[model samples]
Target: MAEWALIFKTAIALFAIVNPIGVIPIFISATDGWPAKDRAHTANTVAITVFIVLTVSALLGESILEFFSISIPSFQVGGGILVMLIAISMMHGKQSTTRQTPEEAQETAERNVIAVVPLSIPLLAGPGAISSMIITAQQSGSFWGHISLALPIAVVCLAIWLALRLSMHIAQRLGTIGINVVTRLMGLILAAMAVEFIAHGISGLFPSLAS
Candidate 1:
């Protein structure tokens, strides 16, 4: 039951951070003027790319931290700050430069193959998302625990794909104001999660505070 609870928490956190609904506008813009088939293909590619990137991060992130001698607590704090920044940006109804800079956005417009580059890499599976997964992976110590993280990752990716697949309909239905409202709501949730991450990290670093 506890494990299932943890998985549910992880899924919610990932969904809030990823915020596929929030990315619908960007997805629409990127695939603008493309054929329906090509657009669908881009959506599929983005989903697959995000799943692979996050899943790999979950498995290898701890080793990478160890290699650099960066403790999980330190990473948690740093990652928490990063996530908080993203949350603030989302609340403002703007995409974070941390996820993709103005240059990348321009490049995305100029490029034809944007599914993996700006869309999946930074736009969806950005540093904040990666860091969150790493932190969760570290907490899940067992092999099965680590592997189970994939389930949520897969679910999130599926959501991403579905959002992108129906991007046009969503954009038309939600409009700008509606989308912004959703983004702000997700941002609020993400901000709370970020606080938790920061608090937990601080407690880990300073055990005395935990008491």
Candidate 2:
């Protein structure tokens, strides 16, 4: 039961951070003029990439940080800032510059395989998501917790694939206004999460300030 609860919380946090529904329009726009089959394939590719990226982050993020002599608290603070920026962008109904710049968008449109670029890297498995996973995994403290985290990550990626595969229908039904509303709600969630991360990191990094 505890493991399941942890998975549920991790899944919700990842889903909120990933915001697949919020990116439906962007996905549609990027795949514009592509055939239906290709779009579906692209969605699959993006989901797989997201799973790989996040799984790698969860498994090896700590080692990577240690290799660079970066502390967990430092990463938490930095990651929080990145997430907060993305959240602010979402609140404004704009894509975060950190996630995808205009140049990257143009390049993604020109590329034959967008699954590895804008769609997967900065779109679905962006820094915020990666950071969130690493921090969450660190908190796990047990082999089961770490192992359990993978399930939710895989499920969230699957959810992203489904949402993208049905982008056309979803877009039509939800419309622009609906999507924007969802974006703002997610932004609010992300903002609160970011603040929590920052505060926790600060307390850990500076024990004197914790009280």
Query: Each prediction's Cα lDDT score?
Result: 0.93, 0.88
Query: After superposition, which runs of candidate 1 have C-alpha atoms over 4 Å from their true positions?
Result: 107-110
Which structure among the candidates has the greatest lDDT? 1
Positional deviation of residue 62's Cα in model 2 after best superposition, in angstroms:
0.7
Quote the RMSD, in angstroms, for model 2: 1.5
Error in Å for residue 60 of model 1: 0.5
Worst 10 residues of 2 by lDDT: 107-116
Residues 1-211, candidate 2, lDDT per residue (tens digit)? 8778878878987898899998899799888999999998999899999999999899888889999999999998998898899899989998788887788888777776777788898988988999999988877877677777889999999899999999999999999999999989989888998998898889889999977
Candidate 1 lDDT tens digits, 1-211: 9788888999999998999999898888777789999999999999999999999999999999999999999999999999999999999999888998888777777776799888888989999999999999988889899999999999999999999999999999999999999999989999998998899899999999999
Compared to the true structure, candidate 1 yields what TM-score?
A: 0.96
| Cα TM-score per model | 0.96, 0.94
Global Cα lDDT for candidate 2: 0.88
